[model samples]
Target chain A: MALRFALLAALYEEPLTGYDLTLKFKTRLANVWNASHQQIYKELGKLHEEGLVSVEDIPQQGKPDKRLYRINETGEAALSDWVNTAHNRPPTRDPLLVKLFAGGLLDRDKLAHELADTRQIWREQLAYYRSVEAQYFTSRAEMPAHFRFQHLALRRGILGMESNLQWLGEVEAMLADLAAGV
Target chain B: MALRFALLAALYEEPLTGYDLTLKFKTRLANVWNASHQQIYKELGKLHEEGLVSVEDIPQQGKPDKRLYRINETGEAALSDWVNTAHNRPPTRDPLLVKLFAGGLLDRDKLAHELADTRQIWREQLAYYRSVEAQYFTSRAEMPAHFRFQHLALRRGILGMESNLQWLGEVEAMLADLAAGV
Candidate 1:
């Protein structure tokens, strides 16, 4: 359901081919949502059938034509309706949390190793998000309205990763102390 | 897949009927994962057929007998193997972020209202998590090993909610200032 709206939101920014939308998900939108190229193409087909989006084909000189998608007024209204309505935060199903919940039954060293690996992954993500912030959002307050709001979503990702890293650090220290009989 | 391990982890503590496992998901396990009752029952059936778990029917008075599930040695080994393997953090799909990303195209007051509602929800959740922490984790060092690990998962939930609430506050303030033409 959210994926439908995510695709609509991406098209709201500008006219894009299905390929361009997939790239947006891989880069800018990676912080918020993820969708495979197949999912993006499938959803675009549904949006077209539902009359929420219209597609135009541009003939290429030496290649297959490109289908560009633009959100119709109905699609903009749908995005507005979804934005105005309040939704409960969806429950997250984390494999690491589940493992930690059952951590007592597992080896401490193995669990700590898992935590370390996860922390490293998050660290790289944080670095990437920071680089984006520095490059594109250095002056968020003065940015055009659309980019301002986009920055908010990216900022949330940065804070979320930071909070996760902090928790991982605390847990790693606790595991160390436990190993030392502290 | 994670759900199967979560159920197995619960049974590792002790055998439980499907009904009892569902209750755990509703309360203590809610922080870690959410599963529909039908999903839980269905997964339990699969685990039984796969020889990962053994089930026994305990007689009851006047009602249908209860089906109790116990993790087998095979189940324990499966859980151990899963725990030892590190997995990349799964991508999160958040409706709030989607709305915020497209927010510039929407009305400001409505977006702010949505933020406030989401903040209220997180505030209540934070309070609930804190209460659980106070009640169950008052003496972390003195707790049995199992409970210490459980506390770590809950603590992560608390931190994550706090981070979310902080982001919500900042966004709301920005929206307010924009409305004021500041």
Candidate 2:
């Protein structure tokens, strides 16, 4: 549902093929949202059927003809309405907490190990966010003004991962204390 | 799947009723994960049927009998294995980016409003994290040694929320700039 409107908004800027939108999503909005190629293609069809977007075919010599999508006026109106009026809280469900709460039943050693593994995962994620930040911020002035908002999202990702890592360390320490009967 | 193991591990500490598990989750592992009463009951039943968790009835005078759940040895082993194993990368999906990408198709004013609304949501989340941190840190010394790990998770939540709020500010600024055509 949100994807439909987002796609329309992107098209409003310039006509793009489904493939182009996917790439844009990875670079520009990678921190906030993601979608599989299959999902993107599916939404494109829905947007066209609803007349929110129009499809154009460009003839090509050897390669497959590209199906370009542009937001129609109606599509623009819909995207605007959604932006202004739509509910803003994104849906979130995390399975890790569920496991942790239930951790009491497992051996203390086992829980400790899981916490360690979770910590490592967060470390990797933190590194990735930092690398991406460096890539974007190196030429900050050359980037689009709107990119500042995306950068903020990236910062959140980094902090979130770092916090998890910190939490994992605490968990590990606690487990060790419990094992030693301290 | 993670829920089952979390619950099993938690039971390893001490037998708990479903309600107790829910409260512990909120206080102990709230940063890493979250679950509702409905999910708790559902998972409990599944665990019981699978012979992973055993339920003992505690008679109460006025209230219903407390069904205390304990992890069986088999469940313990499973939880242990899970903790030691590698976890798959978290699946990524965000609706906000999609809307931003599609912004060109929508009404400019409407898009601006949406960005504003998103900023407000992030602010609220940041406030919540701060409150949680304040409450936890106030009695830091009294916390169990293992709680050190839990504190790290709490910090992560705090930082993550702060970063999100910061991002929203940048986004809001960009939307304003776009509105002003500057």
Candidate 3:
């Protein structure tokens, strides 16, 4: 259901074909609400069925016509209503945390290796988010309302990755000390 | 599948009745991996069928028998194998982020209010984690290997909540400034 609103929000920005919408969702919104390409296409079909979005077929010279999706008035109203609705924070479910909780049952070296691997992954994510910040959120004060909100959302991603990285570092250090018999 | 391992980990600490296991899961493991009582009971049945866990029935004087679940050797081996397996970081999905992404469609004050509400929730969580810390993790240096791992797990929860609170504060301030025409 939230994916419905997220798709509407993406369409609210501008109309795109199913292909373009999936690309845009991956680039911008996947960090917040992860959805597959199939999900996006399926939801687009539903939104059209519900009369919340309209589709237009643009003929191609040598290929199948592309279906362009546009947000209708009903879609706009739904998106607006959803934006105002209160939302609760969802549950946290991290496999790494589970492993850490049971770490004593396994070798400390193995756990440390997992931590290192996770740290590397988060570092790469932080770098990607930083590139996004540099590309789009460089001038916050001059950004329009929509861009400002995008900036805020991006900041959340960046902060979350940074926090994970920091916690992984501290955990790694503590494991090292414990291994040293200190 | 991960929930299976989480349950095995919890039982590795001590044999617990179904009701007692559910309570312990809510108090300790829910932060890392949330599961419903029904799911836990269902998984326990499966684990027992698979010979990963053994269930013992202790008869009470005036009540029904209490079924206590203990991790079997097979369960220990399975959990150890899982702990050694390489796991990827999961994708994030925050409804608040989606709303913030489309926040320009709604009133800024509403977004701010949501941020405030989320901040309060995280603040309360941080306080709760702190209390857990004080109760169990007060002497990190003297903690055994298992306790040290538990401490590390708790630290991840604490750090995650604190980071969320900090990000919410920054986002709220940014929204205030944007509303003030700054």
Candidate 4:
């Protein structure tokens, strides 16, 4: 739903094709929400049917005709109304945590392997966050004011990854102690 | 699905009632997974119907009957299979980030207020992580071997929270800069 609102908001700024919205979502909104190409296409059709967005057909010489979307007045009103309202708390369901909670039922070796694997995955995430941080700090000056808001979200992502990396290190130490019964 | 496995894993150690599972989940597996009573009850019923768990009723004179659950051989096999196989990547979605992405559509002051609120929330989360960290470290000597695995997960939670806090700080700074148009 937030993704829909974001797409509408972007189109409100200026008419954009589905492909354009996808790119914008990645660079500007990837930290907050993600939408696959299929989802984007589906939502565009839904929004058009709902009269919240209007589609314009742009001729392309050899390729498929681009469907440019612009927010309708109804869409603008809906967006405005949504912006004023507080969103509900995000729902969460994590499978890995469940596995950990029941770890006592498994052999120590198997549990250790899972934790080690998780730590490695988080390490990779930390590296990705650092890369994102570097990318933003180096190139953020050229972005628009609204985009700067998106950058704030990216900063959060980077920090979140860093925290996970640090925690993973401490956990490794504890796991080693357990393995040795120390 | 993971929750079911977690419960089965817990029952694999020894039969436990739903209440006991909740308490154990909060402390031992809080980092890895979380489940409400409603969810646990629902899943327990499903597991029973599937013949993956057996529940024995322990009558209490004045209190509710204790429904102690133990994992059946089938359940154990399921858990073993899950551990050996590769799992899908963890899902990641943050609505706050989505809001920030479409922030240009919102009034500037409104966006700033949301950012401030988000920062405060992360600060509270960091404090909670700190408390958890302190508890884990203080009890390190007396904790069980399996607990060491759980502690590793707890550390991950702490680091994830800390990283979010740090990101909040950077975001606050960026918002301030944007407000100042610098």
User: Which candidate leads in DockQ?
Assistant: 3
Model 3 Cα lDDT, one tens digit per residue, B39-124: 88899999999999999999998877898999999999999999888787777778888887876787777776777788788888
Candidate with top lDDT is 1
Measured against the true two-chain complex, the DockQ scores of the candidates, in the order shown, are 0.70, 0.30, 0.73, 0.46
Residue A82 CA error for candidate 3 (Å)?
A: 1.5
For all predictions, the C-alpha RMSD in Å is 2.2, 5.3, 2.1, 3.9
Where does candidate 4 stray beyond 4 Å?
Answer: A9-16, A19-28, A58-65, A105-144, A172-182, B9-30, B58-66, B108-126, B140-142, B179-181
Question: For candidate 1, what is the total of clashing residue pairs?
Answer: 0
What order do you get sorting by lDDT, best first? 1, 3, 4, 2
User: Candidate 4: lDDT over CA atoms?
Assistant: 0.71
| All candidates: TM-score | 0.92, 0.68, 0.93, 0.79
How do the residues B1-182 of candidate 4 rate in per-residue lDDT, one tens digit apiece?
Answer: 57788777667777888898888666555556667888888898899999999899999999999998888889888877775554655646676666665666667677667767766765775577678768665663587656655555566666665666666677667767777778
Residue-wise lDDT of candidate 2 within B1-182, one digit each (tens)? 77777677667778999999899665555555567778888999999999988999999999989999988888887876775554654555656655554433335566566667776766765676678768765673555643444455555556655656665666677667765766
Per residue, candidate 4 scores C-alpha lDDT tens digits across A93-165 of 5565555544555455665676678778767765765676677656834678776766676676666656655
Each model's interface RMSD (Å)? 1.5, 4.5, 1.4, 3.1
**Superposed model 1: Cα runs more than 4 Å off:** A59-64, B61-64
Q: What fraction of the native alpha-carbon contacts across the interface, defined at 8 angstroms, is recovered by model 1?
A: 0.72
Weakest 10 consecutive residues of candidate 3 chain B by summed lDDT: B139-148
Docking class of 4: acceptable
* Deviation from native of the Cα of residue A143 in model 2, angstroms: 8.9
C-alpha lDDT of residue B2 in model 4 = 75
